[model samples]
Target: MVEGETIDTASLDGYVPFDSERQQAYIDAGYWRNITFHDVVDRHAEEIPDYTALVGPHRELTYAELAANSRRIAAYFVGELGLRPNERVVLQLPNCTEFLEAFVACSRVGVIPVMVLPRHRSAEANHVVDLTDARAYVVDYGRYSSGFDFVGLADDVRSSHESLEHLIAVTDGETSSVDGCDAFAEMRDERWVDKYGDEVSKTDVDPSKPGVMLLSGGTTGLPKAIPRTHNEYVFQWERMADAADVRDDWVAFPGVPIGHNASLNCIVGAALWAGATVAVEPELKPDALMAFIERVGGNYTLPMPTQILDILEHPDLDQYDLSSLEVLVSGGQKVPPRVVEEAVDRWNVGFCNIFGMAEGPLICTRPGDDVKVQANTVGRPIAPEADEIRIVETDRETEVPPGEAGELAVRGPGYFTGYFRNEKENTENFSDDGWFFTEDVLARRDDGNLEVYGRIKDTIIRGGENIYAPGIEDELVEHSKIANAALIGMPDDRLGERPAAFVELTDDATELPLKDVSSFLEERGIAVFKRPEYLEILESLPRTEVGKIEKQALKDRIVDAESK
Candidate 1:
């Protein structure tokens, strides 16, 4: 028997629930429904079978094909592999159709899919496996440009983890099984689908249970497991789709990691919820993205700030026809207002700034907003009536004056209640009253909009003056020759710490001297003390696995340069 086949739903523990009052109020407001991923797939397949659901570089899958493939894979997991309900399966594939198939398959059989990025090595992979006690890992056999052997990495993880029992390989080659590992192709084969299809179809699952585990981009240590139920996760996507004004005719291009919250839930999930097609790209190369967008009639996309900058500076940008793009959602960091303005004027596209996290409470600029608001602010909460946002003191208890800078704390129907199995973090990060501390410093504008200044830890104190990195970065990127900018505090013997800047230039031959930078800022009325004391030009900014500028890496480079 399968794990969830005979087990009681109430007996499944380890998931934290929202307060009864808040949950009830959300339900009363019709913000949440008893819906699951399986339900969404089934509904779309039955209602619009010929509609394209997923488009990758290799193939395009219709809604009917997606539903059938998911059921077949679920059958293999339950009947052939004997995966129990609630057992964790680590999915470490790139932006491909297989990732979606695996996600739906896990949902169909009541198994929890722990999404891991393709870039995760043994260190991160082992930690996730040990954290989730994952029963199986689905990896690819060097199908991407990185050329890393995912099969070998899966084997290494299996060796170190006691709970790991299966290694399913997705290969580009014709051969299915390698050694004793099962082939992903075999799971979708007609024979296996015919054999176990009915049995897997008989499996029942609860809609309110934990549906997936997303890794949090924690500032301090290894990523934490953020478990979101089917209803809450779907609510987020539906709300996002409405805000972005996405329609069934839209084609969304997701260039970022499909495992990240913004790309997974907001971009791809939102598109799918609207019955739109998702054009998946493995990487964020400017040329490839522009071509793909032109080729697929891509009407919507959400690219990070760095990616936007690259595309804006691409030499061949004019060669591609991007007129089909309707909207471009840029976030994951401070989006330069200049980029937003230029993208609108240059490409004739609508732009929305999205401020969100894996923990939840997505604040996005709507399509109807003024261009200035779309360029400057991250907009209001998705569901203003149901979501609560407060600018509070650093202690996280006292509310600050309106339009004043303070810590941002939020609570909503879509947000997660707590991190999995981590009581210390929960106690430290979440309030007893249920608000989750975002650790970001924000201020409410007089117009009732929110402006993110920077993170609490992102401040640079030079002598006694506080310098906000985003403030400087936002100004620096306006320079005609500067493509991207990041500010970090470098150690200084005189002032305890002074600000340093790492910049990617639009023209490699052009140099930005310290004097020129000082002159530029002084003309802009920037405070003298807040000016960066050191500047370094680089080919590109170092980015984290999730594509945010890695400030620590920049700091390390500064330290290494000083040491040398």
Candidate 2:
């Protein structure tokens, strides 16, 4: 049976319905303007036709050009492809100008865009297709260097997924020879828009329904789908722009995949909302990124911790001119205090810590914050007056005392109410009153900042003692010889589990012994049991697609070594 058959048309299965009282309150307070992304793009195009809206390595588009291209694509989708309003389309493209155009076009025609990472293969792609009952799959042709044939992948998806009808390819190199596939460039034909522009323009758009679907970043199990309405999503970006101090004249660079929430909403969405320019780089190479920033006079960017560390340690760092960079924001994991200090001192740049999830409530350090606050903690909620953040016990209902460590639960205008189609998980994660439990363990500092201890699941239980991985990892990273550090719990015969250190050294020739590690932690006042018992040196740590260190992968490696 189809997924949406048993679900209400107005409130789809994968989409969580908004609370009526909160919705009305938000609308009345002017937090939600009832405006869609289509409205934002159209208004910008009319008011600032000549403003440069999107820039990539090879091409740049003005607001007027973006609007026209979106309209044409919308017309082709509706008129030629016979796509109905609210149909789901999977968008799996890299960071480029075409990604922006295709996404806006979906919004323009009332089609729901389901975001999928470009690195995702058949396993992930098929799951999304089956979950959403998607009608189309959009991808880029031969653009990635991963050596996988995207055309072949698309064909494979079409063959397995019976609901998917159209395979759209954005050609960068050679056009696909696939018989039924459509070229994305051809969809820009003016003739199609001229013939069916009126009908496509009249497509019914309901602000109450899901406009976009974002994938969760959980480390365990399949990623959950989180849907957000147009009004709420737009309000989120608008507020993010304000909090980040994104200006109209600033050029924003997004180094991560455009499909990720931090990249799409906090970086790209914020830039467009402020009438600024967005510079897109498909790859995250530090050398290429440095050149792009120098060439475009890029003023702002949001990068992961690994990217920042690479840029700081680049061999030819002095060769480029990156003086235009004013604000640098890092998220997706805890930003090492040493990395933050180095970036600010060497580059004379302002570093901000951004902590957020795909579900909602972004906490960021602002320009006016004290330097220590910026370095030590992820600052308070962006909209503290409107958003509610609580430190609660594991039961997720009882509130903990201030400055105590517990699970982080949040409720806000920008946060989603529940997971799409997963009522069982929702009942477990969310409270009866409306708080969405984030599973992350954080404590409120006396200065009103948040000190994130790792995830509740990430805690290493040795015998009966609970040891937070981030707490140990943070101390280990501060060591002069360690470049990066990750702590994972390995099965122990005596204790239930023991902490193991996976470290990437600053000098490859250097060797760090377990005794030395223990001495260093002792000097730093860390408890004896909390210190890691085993030390493994590696060239590098395994990271997720979004650049987070995958602890589960490290645990598996240790397990494999023991089995041998």
> TM-scores across all candidates?
0.94, 0.96
**Model 2 agreement with the true structure over 273-358: per-residue lDDT tens digits:** 99899999887789989999998999889989999999999999999999999888898998888778888878777766888888
Mind giving the per-residue lDDT tens digits that candidate 1 earns over 1-564? 543363244544556777668777877889888678878878899999999999987888999999988988998998899886778899998888888999999998789999888877888899999888999999887555657888899899899988999999887767757875888878887676788777676667766567889998743458888988787888888888988989998999787888888888888989988999988878667888888898999999988877787788788888999989889998888888887888888888877788888889699888778889989999988778778889999678899887788888998888998887788888898988898998888888988888888988898888977788998998887777777889999999989789898898886448889888888999999999888889999998888755688888888888898999
lDDT of 2: 0.84
Q: Which candidate is the best by TM-score?
A: 2
Which residue runs of candidate 2 sit more than 4 Å off their true CA positions? Answer: 1-11, 143-146, 173-178
TM-score of 2: 0.96
